[model samples]
Target: MSRGFKKFSKNSYKFFLLIYKTYKLTKKFHEFDRIFKKLYNLLNFVVFSVFLGVGYGKYCIK
Candidate 1:
């Protein structure tokens, strides 16, 4: 192979590696996002319930 073609091939391989890594990282972030959303929703529900119970208890006492 000519020197120019060899250099081009090497650069191409590096670019492919970069693209593959980006795809893997994106997938990982998506999974993390789903988990985070689930936890956030659960926490929100707990907080809402606490507030609601407190409000009802105070109303009943008065």
Candidate 2:
């Protein structure tokens, strides 16, 4: 008997939700120019931060 949460799907449900939200927002809104731009910038920052953090950790460990 196991405990805690189990992610049985290859793609977690949250990923699906994120994809759906992004798709819907982009498809439905033409005037959400600034909002979409800000969201894109925020996503870029998160991705860059993850890469930078991992690279710095590897350098420190070596």
After superposing candidate 2 on the true structure, give the runs of residues whose Cα lies further than 4 Å from its correct spot.
1-30
C-alpha lDDT of all candidate models, in order = 0.66, 0.59
Q: Which residue pairs collide in model 2, if any?
A: none
Compose the digit string of candidate 2's lDDT tens values, residues 1-62.
Answer: 01212232224446645765786677566556556557766865775687678778888988
Q: Please tell me which predicted candidate would have the highest TM-score against the true structure.
A: 1
Q: Quote model 2's TM-score.
A: 0.49
Per-residue lDDT for 1-62 in model 1, tens only? 34765577578657755755675577667775666557656855775687678778888988
Error of 1 at 11 (Å): 48
Clashes of each: 0, 0
Task: Evaluate model 1: give its lDDT.
Answer: 0.66
